[model samples]
Structure formats: C-alpha cells, structure tokens
Target: MQNLTTKLLAAAALVAVAGCAKKAPEQLPPPPPTETTPAPETSQPTGPVGSTVVPGSKEDFLQQVGSDRVLFATDQYDLSGEARATLDSQAAWLAKYPNVRITIEGHADERGTREYNLALGDRRANSAKNYLATKIDAGRISTVSYGKERPEVAGSDEGAWAQNRRAVTVVITGM
Candidate 1:
C-alpha cells in the first residue's frame, strides 16, 4: 500500500510539471500604416532630387523627412546592402541638385552605454555621409552623431532597435 501511494504521488507530481510547461507564442509585429494624405508644401527644390522622388524640393523631401525610412544593422555602423539600396534613392536626389547640401544624422537605440551609443551613431552617420560623398563632393556632405539621444520607435525590442540604427539625410539648403 505504501509503495502504491508513493507511485501515485510521483505520477501526480509529474503530471503537475507537465501541465505547467507551456510554449509562449512568437511575437508578431504589426504592419506599417499607409500614408494617404498629401504632404505639406514648403519650397522649391534647389538641387538634385531622388530618382523616385525629388530631394531639394520641400514636398518631395517630405516623403522621407521625419519619416522612419532609414534603417541600420544591430551594433553596426557599416551600411548593409539593404541599407545602401535605400540610401541609393537618397543619393539620386542629392545628385539632382548640386547646390543642395545634406547632413547625415546618425542615431542609436538605448540598449548600450550612452557614450558608446553616441560614438556608434557618429560612425553610422559618417558611414552614410562617406558613401554618399563618394558619389558626390565631400563638401556637400556633413555628419552628426545623435547617439541614443532620440529614439524614433522608443521601445526595448528588436523592432525599436532596428528603427534606431539609422542615418538620416537632413537637407540644409538648395543650390
């Protein structure tokens, strides 16, 4: 009888543990929203605009400005092929206007040390600026590292990290 009770208790414990085990569902992010509204007008384009869209022109540039188009790799300043492809469009716009100068703003997420992130952001911005300048004159390009000072997504996940690693082109003026 004692042996039978011990076996029953062991079986119950096993069942309890098995019942407690559960597999969490995978995390699925939502799709980006569509932009249907027309952008606000600012001024005429001064320099070259992107092939798909103009850059020097205020309205055309608005397609990307203050937008989360730019993307980067995790803990990396090197421009990935995907990133270069995206920048390719920006370069096209920069080429359209010779007088237009741009500042490549490098930004990072808040996952690392602040100083490290700042330096990383600077490197990222410079990397983008370097790539673009290679196609044009270095004088037309400038870079700044915002570090993790500002986060576009503002979260502690791969989703936010991806958004943070970016080099944005800020159009200063048209030529």
Candidate 2:
C-alpha cells in the first residue's frame, strides 16, 4: 500500500512539473516546390563593409567583405598600383577578422572570345588573390575565373566595361 502511494505521488509531481514547462511551438516548414534551390538566406549582416565584428551566429555570419576589386587594361593581369591600393584594403580587412575565408571571382569585359575571356578572368582573379595572400593568410583565399559570363554591371560602354574587367572577392560562409 505504501509503495503504491509513493509511486502515485511521484507520478503526480512529474505531471505537475511537466504542465508548468513551456512548450515549443511547432514550426510549419516551407512547402516543397517543383524546383529545389539553395535555401534563401537573409543578409543578416548589414554592418560596415570592413567591420571586424562577426555578426549573428558564427554559422550565419558570412559577409561580402570585399566587393568589386579592379582589373586592368585589355591584356594585362599584373596588379597595377591602382589595383594594389584596392587589394591593400581588402588584405587589411581579412587580417582584421581571423575566421573568414574567401573566393576571388575574376571577370572580363565582353570584348574577346569565350575562351580568351575565361583565361583573362583567371589571370585577373589570381592577381587579386595573390596580392591578398601576401598580406594575409594564404589559406583564407581561393580563386575562380568566371570570365565574361558574370558581369558586375552589364553594357558596352567604357563605364560598364571598366566594371566588368575586375576581380570580386566573395566571402564564403560557415567559416
């Protein structure tokens, strides 16, 4: 009789405690679609472009640290003094934040054959990547050539051409 009473009392106490606990709301996940794309990501960090402060959860903190860094004339990938100035700032920012990795996207203006533009883009991106690696850790950077396939600004004028002839540094997430 005593053991029965004790078990009943413990069960009642457990029920009471459970009742007081807050319940997590059930989440309704997004519906499945005909096509699957990467989950939409919000720009969680609108902080200053070069700010060293990591934003949000370490997992959600990917930032576009460097934007469109410059490339050069019709047939050159060497880092010009002007281009070096742009990369100098990029390198400084990377050094400021230790746990970041990046990809350098090289692009070219639409003035050449596809293969030629692709090669040009590679040269452009590698130039910027090399410059950054010199000032920061080499392991933090990777380079890819998008050539003329991707353009920061689209058009045929010198203004658009200038924008396209460039290397863009993209901050990779989940560092």
Alpha carbon lDDT of each predicted model? 0.74, 0.74
**Highest TM-score, which number?**
1
lDDT of 2 by residue, 1-175 (tens): 9999999999999999999998887987786663222233344444666655444222222343343467688767888887888788667556655666778898899889999999999988888887888899888789999888988787999999887888887766542
Q: CA RMSD for every model?
A: 17.0, 13.0
Per-candidate TM-scores read 0.63, 0.62
Candidate 2 wrongly placed segments (more than 4 Å): 1-68
What's the TM for model 1?
0.63
Q: Candidate 1 — which residues are off by over 4 angstroms? A: 1-55, 64-69
Candidate 2 Cα deviation (angstroms), residue 57? 10
